[model samples]
Target: MLGIKEIEAIIPHRHPFLLIDCVEELEPGVRAVGYKCVTFHEDFFRGHFPQEPVMPGVLIIEALAQVGAVSILSVEENKGKVAYFGGINSAKFRRKVVPGDRLRLECEIIKQKGPVGIGRATATVDGKVAVTAELTFMIG
Candidate 1:
């Protein structure tokens, strides 16, 4: 399990911007499980839908990326390297995520070659997948 202190060391995100609440499991560059709590006060909820707020799909992907970041950087060789989103493919949003939902993101590293990494991730809300994607990143 990774606490906030450990997470803060790997990613540059902060409160309101930090999507991952805690990393429940981590296997270096292999796999990770992270959590996020959706609240009505989320910044994007204000303008996303004034009357009927739905968490943005992009943010769901971002949450996945955050978990992927921690997993990738956990490798001792890549410590302190910057991880940037290189591309996204086959992304699907299956359900709407709103306030009061607790999101769990599961990410598995598909490949890590040199400074380039690829992963598959899924974000679940209430035990159902809300988003899934093939994410690529450049680490340097």
Candidate 2:
């Protein structure tokens, strides 16, 4: 398992932008499973909705990408590098993610060629899927 500090070492996100809290499982350059503890204090809640706050779908995808980043950047050769989003494909939001949700994020490297790769990513809440996407990234 990896915490925010370890995750910070692998990816270039911080504070409000760093969506993941802990990584429960990781296979360097292959796959990762992580968690995001949603809370009412999130800044987005103020504008996303005043009465009924919903975790934005784009942020869910970003959380999944961060997990994918951990999987790729943890590899020895990719250390100190950054993973940039090349594209997002087949992104779907199945349910609304709200405060107090513990989002489970998982990603697997489905394809790769040189510095570019594709990840099959998903985010779930209480075993129910909230979002899924195929993320393309480039290691820099």
Model number with the top TM-score: 2
140 in model 2: Cα distance from truth in Å? 0.7
Clashing pairs in 1: none
Per-residue lDDT of model 2, residues 1-140, tens digit only: 99999999889999979999999999999999999999999999999998999999999999999999999999999999999999999999999999999999999999999999999999999999999999999999
lDDT of each: 0.92, 0.96
Top model by lDDT, which number? 2
Superposed model 1: Cα runs more than 4 Å off: none
How far does residue 129 in candidate 1 sit from its true spot (Å)? 0.9
User: How far is 30's C-alpha from truth in model 2 (Å)?
Assistant: 0.7
Which residue pairs of candidate 2 clash? none
Q: What is the lDDT of candidate 2?
A: 0.96
What local lDDT does model 2 show for residue 24? 100
Write candidate 1's Cα lDDT for 63-109 as tens digits: 99999999998899889887899999999999999999999999999
Candidate 2 Cα errors over 4 Å, as ranges: none
